[model samples]
Target: MTSATRPYGTRERRRSIGSQGESRGGGEERTGPAASEGQEATAILERARAAVDPELRAAVDSLPRRMRRVARYHFGWEHADGTPAAENAGKAIRPALVLAAATALGGPAARAAAVRAAAAVELVHNFTLLHDDVMDRDTTRRHRATAWTVFGDADAILAGDALQARALGMLAEDPHPAAAAAAARLAACVVELCEGQGTDTALEKRAPAEVTLDEVLVMAEAKTGALIGCACAVGALYAGAAPEDVDALDAFGREAGLAFQLIDDVIGIWGDPGHTGKPAGADLAARKKSLPVAAALASGTPAAGELAELYARPHVPEDPDDLDRTALAVERAGGRAWAQDQAADRMSRAMDELARAIPDPESAGGLLSLAEFVTRRST
Candidate 1:
């Protein structure tokens, strides 16, 4: 239903994140148990979450009845109660990047086009999530049944199509020249994302030992970093910033996106079920060729032998005992360590990009913190 008819809690959760989002300062150095002392990214993420508008609730509510069901499932609106609520909704990093770049360029918060641009970025993000679940054959997402699991893949795909259309519509109608430019960049990024996914799927067919770190990095940058960079650049453009300034923000966004994906790789391998909302070693069970798995296979470690066998198997193991065996094989192969190092390197680059992008220490502080936040998150 429409936002007016929806419960305040649902709207608030979808439109704006909870205050706990501000606590993301933990996980600075993931190796240690203790969290980081300083905070920068947490604040920016909080702001982004606050500014995020509930898309399915607002935009999808007006769709045809069949289309609405598809959209609602993706947003966790029509799902049964006691289902898992998403932790942090990914920090609203992309939208925040957009807004932060805008503020750095001296733009006011009242800029309507910038707000719409921010919302558009988030819609694209969720759209990707919907398709990702189906592609991965994932049963659960955000600790609940995935859209494809409940509504079927066809419906979920249609929902993604609708959200994508809405994103373009928002950008086209935007009053600001800069926002429009940024939206165009975002559209280009979507094309790049599709290309990267194609490459990634192709790479999976080849032996992991054949895939180099450089190739993996290329895929990661295109599939994940492009959109993130667009978020920052779009924010800057919306603020009427110069091209050079927007490019710098773009650099920051790309690095930050890489860092974000690297950490995701780690979580996919070793994250706790309670926190990750999935079974431990979930990625390994799925034979996902993520950054870590690719590296370990390239190393030709014994873990690689195990990984190879796991991939060659006719079917996924149904028994928990067999699944755990596969998990140990991946861990033994050095996938975990390799992924962690990649994440650290990506984080360093993200910080470097942020530092160089904005000269003013105060304005850059939030961006800097956001980079750190992406690196250290558990889920």
Candidate 2:
């Protein structure tokens, strides 16, 4: 595939500078080039979570046995090998987005209500992942067996459902109007996520070549972008920011969310096993219609022909050679380059939206740094 096959429209080009056309060498750490930035982001994320309300901790603790156990296991509170260890949990990007958006809008007091809102969003995210694992028949999450793999599918589903309930329950705990709005937004995003997931699953059974870039973007925005935007807007609402600012934050979150998904798609294809906890080219082996693959297939280049032939082959477990061929096919089809460009562009838009949302240099600088962190992260 070549740039000639790319379906990027005028608007997309206008908003992004594209990537620097640099190809990452095999076995290189995803974030090795940006090690310092990753460390900084990791540190900031830890400090923020460390300051979380004790009440929130208690709320998490008060979960029922089954739900709590699954939550603890999924959050890296337990070891992947079934031993005990306090490994780092998720990066908590969504919650951090909430808090940073809140702080940027006003003082911490005004956004105090956002603490619960952030927690609620995080719970909702974990809930989705639990169910997603079951649907995808995924054995692992965060390098550990998924809840459904360890427990029965029924039990995992129930736990996910319970977590969703807890998120809403937490939102409703506060009688404040902002709490109500946040709850409403969260509910809406969940519903949209379900719809997007359905579409994504259906697409897998069909030809990846038939899928367009626009449809992929729609699915990505709905499934992944919605929650991210909700996190930011919820934060702004809890902080009592102006309606205009809240809307701007929503846009910023949406763009950032898009960038996040693009990077995740890249990792799903090319990421190191040590960092991503999944084998390289997992998406290709699964025949999932990820962005890069979708674009390559649609381009109908020689690389696309190779992918078509591979897809037509009998279903079997892919080995290293097959994975390497798949990766090379995608690259020749111009997939990797196009995807990297899109990620960079989306990140730029995210930053621009943030600037418009929060003009304060000091706080906006933090959000900007966070945006850079997201774009540059390897895992």
Best by TM-score: 2
Among all windows of 10 consecutive residues in model 1, the one with the lowest summed lDDT is: 12-21
Off by over 4 Å in 1: 1-43, 54-56, 80-90, 110-113, 314-332
Instruction: Name the candidate that leads on lDDT.
Output: 2
- The residue pairs in collision within model 1 are 41-369, 41-370
Q: Candidate 2: deviation at residue 80, Å?
A: 8.7
- How would you encode candidate 2's per-residue C-alpha lDDT over 197-264 as one tens digit per residue? 88787777777656787898888988888888888888889888788888888888888788777777
1-379: candidate 1 lDDT, tens digit per residue = 2112321122222211111122344533333322341244566677667666564257767667776776665666564332433433445777877777777665566334477788888888878878877886778877777878877889888888888888878788767766567767889988888878778777767765577778888999998998888888888788777788778788878877886786677667666677667666777766767887777776677777877787666335666666666656766887766666555555555555555556555676555556555665554
lDDT of each structure?
0.67, 0.73
Model 1 clashing-pair count: 2
**Where does candidate 2 stray beyond 4 Å?**
1-37, 53-56, 79-84, 175-177, 314-319
